[model samples]
Target: MTSRRSFLKTSAVLGTGLLMAPNLYARNKKYIGVQLYTVRDAMAKDPVGTLAKVAKVGFNTVEGATYTGTQKFYGMDPEQFKQVLDDNGLKMPSGHYMLGDGMPNAKGTIANEWQKAVDDAAAVGMKYMVCAYLLDGERGSLDHYKETAHKLDLAGDICKKAGIQLCYHNHDFEFKQENGKFPYEILLNSTDKDLVKMEMDIYWIYKAKQDPIALFNQNPGRFPLWHVKDMDKTPKQMFTEVGNGVIPFKDIFKHAKKAGLEYFFNEQDICPGDPFNSITQSYSYIKKNLV
Candidate 1:
């Protein structure tokens, strides 16, 4: 029954199928991550249980939000925390840290005992440590921003020694014009590019009426991480599930390679109902639509 014509056609079809298989496998290989801040309450109550639930919901990575208060990851020391993450089959490649002023007396902050924090992060196998936020008291003038940029570079040097990258997470405030110049611009220009990279918060950039694409074009390969939270279409512009909001995530994700994006975390600062439900919804939408 093996005619030459039929066998040749069958071979061509099989070759086509084989060619398409690699693309499907590559698509499945993209990592999906979540910010633990989305489940703050549950983490506060029971971090291990919360992480288990997060893994059950199909998130392979998590970004930490709390550290300064206790100098620990989710109320556990670095070793214990890493074990919990391994137990749940999760990886934490990045975590948030406050600038020295936010909690002045904190032991493991960037300003106080930075070496210890960096060491702990290395112990946890983290590849990146982020300067989480700047308080109003901490940010005032361009001079202050320059000083902060210098500090970031210094912190970054410590991170570099540990084989970890240092990044800055931004809010809309950095875009505000102070002395006829954007502090964010100062931060980008003042720091050593290799030492201090950016964690572009897509939601906040949009909220500030800035274009993420433009930023990517301006500073190629400088943004190594992203906070992939979305904003609602309402006038209030509240946080919403990833695809449920108006952000063009598909378009944004298309430029991931150009932006040097290694990892991105879905974060919703506030949720309407159960936070786990919100995170699950976001994870589903992101997995279906964006990488």
Candidate 2:
């Protein structure tokens, strides 16, 4: 029998013709954004100035990565941050938040502070609030993931009432197996489809040796957000600028419709040089080739 990777490679090739049709390629006009975490240092120093630079670099949207203890966005209140984004012609459709640790108290319901995070995200004109990461302690067995899924569903209901959606962003750890089962699969199976969605990080999934196309095929329309980072060709597979790497982004993007991709952000966890320059490089490549 063929391996899953082999099957995906063959399917990707066979599906190319269908994805290349005029109607399909036309959908590439959706807004391209950058995850602000790429410029964390600059944002911490000066969010207003950083946002201005992001707009100047031709990014139409951004995904925020700073929202912790203070319950504020980049040192500014939600209203103030929204204004900064608007002034620079940028919009934040989604933002990352921690949902496991302090979010829920002993009662298993969302704490007041977590509710504030949800409210602030909506106030800032965000359409999605993503639970961005799962700490090591939070991941032990499949049961833990199932409990997390339940918590996510509850959080999703809170977001729904505020006219926003709640999603989960993945790194490579979710792909690790425990007792012959994948935690990623457990989360997908346990969570209600309407309640919790996924933000697929292409680079990490590739690093984990998983087939994105296969996941998309298995759970069509479940992935609404994508982190479009690239992997270096080196043995370590370090993160690299989009077009300078080995990932087949153009081919993967051809299946955006099936993936339910609403917005995609360029995110490089570590930049070799200036983050702004790195993001500009990725932006230029996407504009010239992928988009």
Instruction: State how far residue 216 of model 1 sits from its true place (Å).
Output: 0.6
TM-score of 1: 0.89
Q: Candidate 2 lDDT (Cα, whole model)? A: 0.82
Best by lDDT: 1
lDDT values of the candidates? 0.84, 0.82
Error of 1 at 78 (Å): 0.9
**Best-fitting candidate, scored by TM-score:** 1
Per-residue lDDT of candidate 1, residues 1-291 (tens digit): 333233223323212322323232122236788999999999999999999999999999899988876789989999999999999999999999988866778877889999999999999999999998998988989899999999999999999999999999999998787655678877877888779889999999899887787676556667779999999999999999899888999998887765677889999999999988898999999888885
User: Across residues 120-204, which tens digit of lDDT does each residue of candidate 2 receive?
Assistant: 8888999888888887877778898898889889989888999888889999998777775678877777887768888999999
| TM agreement with the true structure for every prediction | 0.89, 0.88
